[model samples]
Target chain A: MNGSSKKYWTDDPEMVERYVLGRLSEEEKRRLDAEIAECEPCREMLRRETLLAAGVRRFGRDGLRSRLRRRLVRERRSPVRMYQSVGLAAAVVIIAVGVGVYQMFFADLTRPTQFGKKEIVITQGGEIGEAREEKREVRTPEEKMDAPPPEAKPAVRSGAERNVRPAEAAKRTAPEPIQEFAPAAKSDAAAARSIWLLGTVVMETGAARTGAAALSAESRTADAAAPQASPDRPVTLRRGDVRNDVALRQRPLSALPTARRSQMGSARRVETLVETTGDGGLQLTIYTDDVAASELDAASVETLDGDSLVVTTATQRILYRLPPDLFTAPSVRTKR
Target chain B: MAARLFFLTPDAEILDLIRSGDEEGLVMLYSANERMVRVFVTNNSGTPDDAEDLLQEAVIILWERVRAGTFERNAKLSTFIYATVRNLWRARLRGMKREVPADLAERDDASDEPSPADALAGSEMAAAVAAALDRLGEPCRTLLLLYYWEERSMEEIAAQLKFANADTAKSKKYQCKKALERILTDERII
Candidate 1:
C-alpha cells in the first residue's frame, strides 16, 4: 500500500465527486477513509469538499426553512381548525338545506286548517253582506224617502258639500230619522279601514319591496317615529327622496357663504330670504305651497311666522332662518 | 453468571447501555467531545458563539444518525465525532464570502509547546514566509492557502475552482509551492 502507483484511491475525479455528494460505496469509502488517516493530501481534499457542500446546503436550508415555517404557522392559526372544521361546516350546510326543504314542502301542513276554513267562511259572508247593503241603499225614489235622513245626508252632502259650506249643508240635511242607518255605515267604514290596515302590515313585513328604496322607506318611517319619541337621538337618514332633499339643502348651508357675486347671490334666484335671529339664528321664508306632512321632523316644529321659520344649531353657533316653503317651490335643482 | 458477563464485556457494553436511550451515553459523549468540537469550530475562523452553535449542531447530527442506526462502526467514536466537527467547520468556511488567511493553518502548531527556534521572538523565518506569500500572484497565493489552511486534495481544489482536471490543480499547487520556496531561499529564511 505504501509504494502503490495507482492514484484511483488518491486523486481520482470520480472518487472526489462521490465523496463530495456522500454517495460512495461502503467498501470504497472505508478504503479511502483508511488512506486518509495516513495521507495528509487526501485529508485536505476531503476537508475542502466537505466545506463547499456544507456551505451550499446551508444557503439552501436557510431560505427553505423560513418559507416552510411561515406556511406552517399560517396553517396552524387559520380561522377554522383543520380536522373537524370541514365536517362541522358540512353539517351546518346540511341542516340549512334540510330546514329549507321542510319549509318548501310541508310548511302549510303545520298551519291550522280550521283557521283557514273560518277565514274563507267570513270572506264569503262579507261579500254577500256587502252586496245586500248596496242593494238596500239603491232603492227606488219613493222608498228612498222612507230611508233615514242621517244616511241620506252624509251620502248627499259628501258629494254636494264642495259647493256649499259643510256646516250649512249638514244642518239642512240632518233629521231625527237617521239614527238607525249609523250601524250599516259604521260596518262599511270598518271594512274599508281593515283593508288599509292589512295593506300596511303586508308592506311592513312581507317580501314585496326590496333593494335601496325599500330600505330607505323603512329608515324614513323609523326616523319619523324615532325622533318624536327621543329628541337627542341621532337621525339616520337613508339615501332617499327625503335624504336627497335634506342633503341638497345642507350643501348650500354647509357651503362657505362667499361674498363673490354670482347667480347664487342674484335677487331673482334668491326665492327665500334669510334673516338672523337675536341669538344669531336664521329665519327663512319660502314663497310656495305647503310642505308635506310626511316630510316634517316631528321633534322640531317649524312655526309659521308669515312664511318663514327660524333654525338654529347650538353646536354650529350659526343661525339660519329659512323659508318654510322653499323646498315646495320650483327652484334650481341642487345636486347632492 | 451476571458478574462474569459484566466483567468480560468491555466499556463498549457500558456505552451501548448509554446509547440505548440512556442519559449516561449523552453525558459521556458531551463531556468527551465538546471541547474538541468547540476548538475545531473556533480555529476555523468561527467566533465563540459560532463555535457553540456548530458544536451543538454536530452533536445533534451525531445523536440523530446514531439513533437512526445509520452510524457506521469502522472509525473510533471519537475520530468519527472529530470528523463530524471538521466537516461542520469546512462547511462554514465554504459558506463564508471571504477567504480565510493561511496563518490559521499554523494555529495547531502554535498551540503545541514552542520549539527553541519558534520561541525566538521576531524571527526572520516568519518575515520571510510572509514576504514570500505576499510576492506570489493571487492564483499562487490562493492555491497555497487552500492547500495549507483547508488541506484540500488536488481533485477537490480543481473541482472547487472549476479546473479541467486534478493534474492541472496538482501542477498549479506544485508551482505555487516551488515559487514560495524560491522566495524563502532568496530571503535566506530556509
Candidate 2:
C-alpha cells in the first residue's frame, strides 16, 4: 500500500468517500490513517477530495443563500403591491356599484320624448276643462307624430290603472311607450263622449340641426255652445257652409273634418288632426298656426259649431275656442 | 416576511424538498432556524454574520445527509437544526481559540489536528478549487456540486439533469471531475 505502484485504500473511490464521510470502522480508519501517512499519493488524493467537497459546499451555500435572501427582500416589499392591486380592484367595484345604484334610484327615467298626459273633461253643456298638469312626464312614441284620428283602443284597466294619476299613467305606460294610435272615432259626437287630452310632441331633429322647434298646444275652452242636436250625445263642433257670411262672422271659430277623416280618401289636406291616446283615451292637438296667424285674411275657414272652430291654411293650423254666445241668438246653419 | 412564513412549513414538506434536492429546502431550514441560531450565537459572543454562516453550514450538512438517503427522522427538524448550529458554533469558537500560535502548535502536536502550516495550505487549496469550479462552467459545475456537496445518487443526478441513465450520469460526472481537476491543475491551484 505504501509503494507508488501498489493499490491503496484511497485508490478506491468508495473507500475514499467512506473515509471522508467518517463511515469507516475504527480498525479501517486506523489502517487508512497509517497508510495515508506513509503514502504521499493517497494523502494528496484525500486532500483533493476534501478540497473539492469544500468548494462545492461553498458554492451551493452562496448560491442558495443568496436566492433565499433575495426572496426575503422581495417579500418584504410585496405587501404594498398587494394592497395596491386590491385597492384598484375595490375602487373599480365601488364605481360599478355606484353607477348601478344611481340607475336604480336616482337617474332620470323620463326623457323629453315622454310627455305627461293632461285630461280635458268636456261637460254636457260643452264646457271643456283640463285636469291639472303633473310634474312627471309621460312616455310616448319614440318619434312624435301629429295626432291620429280618435281610434277606439281598449285599455287594459287594472284597479291600479283606474286610480292612476297623470304621473302614474306615465309610469304604468312606460314599458310600452310607443304604442300605435288606433283609428279615430267615427264622428264628433263620439269624440265628445270619449276622454280627451292635450299633449305636446317634440319632433326629432337631425344631429346637425340644433334649433328645431318644439310644437305644443295651449289648452283653451269654448265660451259658446250650439243648439243640442240630440239628447243621447253631447253637441260637438259640426262643419257648416263655408261661403255663408253669417257663419264666417264667427271670429276665429271654424272647423273642418279631422285629418284622419281627410286621410280616408277625401283628398283634402287635413291641417288639424285628433288622435285616440294609447291608453283608450282621445287626444286633440291645436298647433300654434303660424301660417294662419300670418295670413288671417287668406286663411281658409269652415264652421265647426258656435263654440269651437278650427282655422287652417295650407301648412298651418289653430284651434280657437270662441267666447260663449249665451247672449247671442243661435243662428248656426248645419250643412247637409 | 414571506420567507419567515416558510418557517411554519411542516417537517414532512422540508424532508420531501431535501429528498428531491430542491434548493428551496435549504432556504426553508435556514430561515426556520435563523432566529434561534442568531440568538444562540449572539448570546455566545458570536455576531449575526457568524450566526448566518454557521446556520448555512449546518443546513448544508443536513442537505448532504438527506440527499445521500442517510438522514434519520428521529427528532423534529428544528431540534436537529438547533443542535447542529450549537455544535458548529462551538467548533468555530474552538478554531478561533486555536488561532493563537502556542495553542495551535500544542493542539497540532498533541492530537491528529493538522498543523497550522497544513491548515493554511488546505484553506488556500480549497479556495483555488472553488475558483476553478466556477471556471469549469455549467453541467460540470452543477454535477460536481450535486455529487460532492449534496451527495446525490447517480440515478437522481441522471433524472435531475435529464441524462439517459445512471450510467450516463456517472460517466458525465467522471468527465466533469476530470475537467474540474484540469482547470485546477492548469491554473496551478492544486
Candidate 3:
C-alpha cells in the first residue's frame, strides 16, 4: 500500500479529500487508509476536515432542538398534571411538618427583656413638649466615671421645646435630634442601642410639680424648668377678696375629662418619655394617653399607672411617687 | 402522556451526557426532534425512508462530534441537527432526481448534478487523521473537505468554487494534500 501510494502521491492534495470522503475505489481507499495510518500529514488533514464537517452539521441542527423540546413538553403536560398536584401537596405537608418539628425542638425559652419607660416633659410655660424613651445604656457606671463626657451630638429643638425650661431659655433653636433607634430585633443577637442627644434630658415620669415647689388651688407656686412649657395663652386671673385669695377661677375638678384623667393618670403613674433639654437635663414627659400607652416601654408602661416623678439625670434615674393632681394647676412656681 | 425528557434536563448537561455516550441523552434528543426532522424531509420531496436515513445520518454526525468534543458549547443542539439533516437530505433528493429535485424545498439553483465526489456522502476518520488535518488550510482545507469529506466531483467543485475546470480542481487538490503533509511535518502531527 505504501509503495502504491508513494508512486502516485506526488502533489496529490485532492487525494486527501477523496480518500477522506471515501470517493476512492476499493483498492485506492484501502491503500490510502494504510498510508494515512503511517503518514502524519495525510492523517492530520483528514482529521481537520472531518471535525469541520461535524461542526457544520452541529450548526444546522441547532434551531430544531429547542422547538421540538417545547413540542414534547406540550404533548406531555396533560398526563403530568396529576403528579404535579400530588407533588405540590406533598411539599406543603413537608414544610408544615418541618416547622412543627422546629418549634417543638428548637424554640428559645428566655423571657423577653423589659425596659423602664420614662416621659420627660419640659414645662416652660405649660406648653408640654414631651419626649419619651426607656433605656440608653451605652456606658457602664464604671466606664462613665472613668471617661470625660464625649462631645455632644446634634439635636432638634423647637422654640417652645427649647424654652420649656426657664433656666436654659438661651439655647439656640435647632432641628430636634433625629435619633433613629432601630426596633429591638427579635434575634438572639443583643447589641447596645446608641443614643445621641443635643439638649437637656428631662426624664418624664408621669409625676411633675409635686414637691414644695408646686401650688394648691388657692395659692401660686413656681418652678419653671424643662418637662413643662408655660402656657402661651394670656392669664385669666380671678383673685377673691378673702384672705389667702390668690383666687384663680379653678376649673371644677369635674371639668377634667375622665379620659384625660386616666391618660394623665397613666401618664403620671408610669414613666414614658425621656427628653433631654438645655445643659443636658433629663426631660421626662410621661403620657398615659392611649397614644402614649402604645409607646411606653413595658417597664415604664407599668410604672405610668402609679403617680410618681422619676427624675433621670446624668448620674442615675430617681423615681419619686407623688399625687396625680400636681399637674392640675394651670401654672406652677418654684419657691421664691 | 409521557413527560418530555429534554425539558427535564438542561441543554449543557444534555451535551455532556451525549458526549459521555449516554443512551438516554440520545433518546431524549430523538424523542424531542425526530418529528420535526421527519416533517422537514417529507415536505422536501423525500420519502419516509429518505427522512429516516437523513435523521440517522444526522445522529451519527452528532455522535461523532460529541465523541470528538468538536461541538460548540454555545450552539443549540437542535439547530445543528436540523442543518445537518437538511444538508444531507438535499443531497439525497438530488440523488433521487437524476435531472433535478421536483420539490421547491429540495431544489437548489445549481445547474449541474454533483460529480463522483457525491458518492462519498457520509464518513468520519480516525482521531489521529482529524488531528493532522487541523494543520492544513486555505484552498487545501476546502479542497480536501469537498473532495474527501463531502465527496463532490471535481466538476461540481470547479463550478461551486469557480475553478476553471475539472483539471484545475484536480491540481488544486494535489497541491493542497502536499500542503497538508508539509503542515503536519512542521508540527510533527504524525
Candidate 4:
C-alpha cells in the first residue's frame, strides 16, 4: 500500500470495510491478510469491520428481498396481461358464432342461396298450380263460359283485388270463354288444330314500380342541385356518354344508368322452371328456381304461360300447349 | 418479463421517479408496496406507526441509492423496499433494548421462515454503525452503500454520480469513507 494512504486504512473506516467486506481482488485480499497477520493495529481494524460489514449486508439483503416479493405480485395483478388473455378467448367465441350464423341463416338469405330456396318453393307452388290446371283440363270451353268467373266465388276471393276489373275485361266484356280461341268442335280436323289461350295478367307492380322510379328521380334531382338552388329543381339526367345521350333523347325505359338502377333497386331475384310430361294425359309442371333474400311471399301460376306476363321480375318463363286431338280422341268416344 | 403498469408506462419510470424525488412516485410506491412492508413489520413486533415510519425511511434510503447510482437496478423494487423496512424496524428494536427475534439476527436463507441462530458479541454494534451512517452526508452515505453494500463498480459510480472518471469517483469515495470514520471517531461509536 502507498505510505501516504496507509494510515487511512484504519483512519478511513471504508478501507477496513473493503477488507472486511471481501470487496478486494484476490491479490489485494492476500496482501491485506498478510498485513493483518503482522500488524496489530490492522487486526484490530479487521475485527471492527467484520461487525459493520455483517450489519450492512443484512440491511442490503433484506431491502432487496422485499422488493422482489412485491414485484411478483404486481406482475400477477397487471390488467394488461389479464385482459390480453381474456380478450383473445372472447374474440374466438364471437367469430365462431358469427361464421355459424352466416352459413346457417344469413347465407340462405342472399341472392345465390335464395335460388335453391326458391326452387323448392317453386316446386310447392307448381304442385298447387298443377292441381288447378287439372281442374281446368277437365272443363270444356262451353261449360267454362256457362259458369261464373272463378274470382266471383266467395271461397276463392279476398281484398280489393277481387273486385278489380280483370286486365282483359275491355276485350271480353261478355267473355266468349275460348270458343273464339279453342272451340270444342266435334270434327276431328277441328280437334287437331293448335289452340292457344293468351295468358292474361293481374297488374300488381304497375303503381309500385312507377312510384319507386319517381321517388328515385326526385331524390336524384334534390341531391344534384346546389344548396342555393330552388327546392323545385327539375331532375336532369346527365348525358355523359354518346350512348346515354342517344338513350335520353329516345326517352326509352333504358334512358340512363339511373333508370336501370332504379328498376333493379326495387327488384328481387327470381327464377322459374317448367317440365312437361306426356304420361296418361298431357301434363305440364312449373316451379320457381330462385327467390329473393327474404321469404317467398307470393307465388302464382295461370294458363300455360309464365312467371308473369308484364314485369322484369319474371327471371325466366316457359309455356307449353296440349294437342287439340285430346278432346275428341276416339278412345274417349268409345268409352262414352 | 414484467408486464407494463397503467398507461403502459415503462418499468424504468420507477427509477426515474425515485431519482427525481417526486412526491407522487413516493406515494405510489408506498401504496403499491405497503401491504408487504406493513405485514412484515407488524408481524415482527412493530406497530402501524413503526411500519409507516420504517417504510418512509426505506423509501428515502432507496431514493438516495437510486440518486447516487448505488441501487442495484436488477433487483426488484418491492423486495428491496420491504427488506429495507424490515431491517430498519429490527435495528430500531435493538436500539429500544427489546429482545429481537433470534432469526432476525442472521441473514435470511431464502426460506423467509427465519430459524434462530446464536447472537454475536457485537450485535449491539448495529445501532451504533447505523447512527454513524446517518451522520455521513448524503454523498458519502450513498457512496458507501454503492461501493460496500450494493457492490456497484467504480466506473458505474463515476457515471451515476457525474464524477470526471472512475479515478475521481475512487478519490471521492475515499474522502467519503474518511468523513464516515471521522463521525464514528467523534461519536466514539466505532
Which segments of model 1 are wrong by more than 4 Å?
Answer: A1-336, B1-19, B101-190
Candidate 1 falls in which docking quality class? incorrect
Which candidate achieves the best lDDT against the true structure? 2
Ranking by DockQ: 2, 4, 3, 1
Q: Candidate 3 — what's its lDDT?
A: 0.41
Model 4: lDDT of residue B7: 34
DockQ of predictions, in order shown: 0.02, 0.18, 0.05, 0.09
Residue A276 displacement in candidate 1 (angstroms): 99
Candidate 1 at residue B81, lDDT? 63
Model 4 bad stretches (over 4 Å): A1-17, A20-38, A44-336, B1-12, B19-24, B43-45, B60-76, B79-164, B168-190
RMSD of candidate 4 to the truth, in angstroms, is 23.5
Q: Write the per-residue lDDT of candidate 1 for residues A1-336, one digit (tens) a residue.
A: 334575647577447645654556779878888888888767766654443333323322233234444544565566655656877989999998887556434444222112211211011012111111233242212112222233221111110001112222244434212110111111221111100000001112223222212223333333221111123332332222232112101111111112111112222222222222222222222211111122222213233233322222211111122223323322211111
Better of 1 and 3 by TM-score: 3
lDDT tens digits, residue span A1-336, model 3: 333445544136456544533346779877767766777766655665444444223322332334444544565574576688789999999998887555433443121222134322332223333333336632212123222123312111111111122223224244222111111111222211111111222343344222222223332111211122212221221212211111001122222223223222222232222222222222233221211111112122112234433333222233533322222222211111
Tell me the alpha-carbon RMSD of every candidate.
27.9, 21.0, 22.0, 23.5
Give the alpha carbon lDDT tens digit for every residue of B53-104 in model 1.
5655544445434543445566455666666655555545666755655643
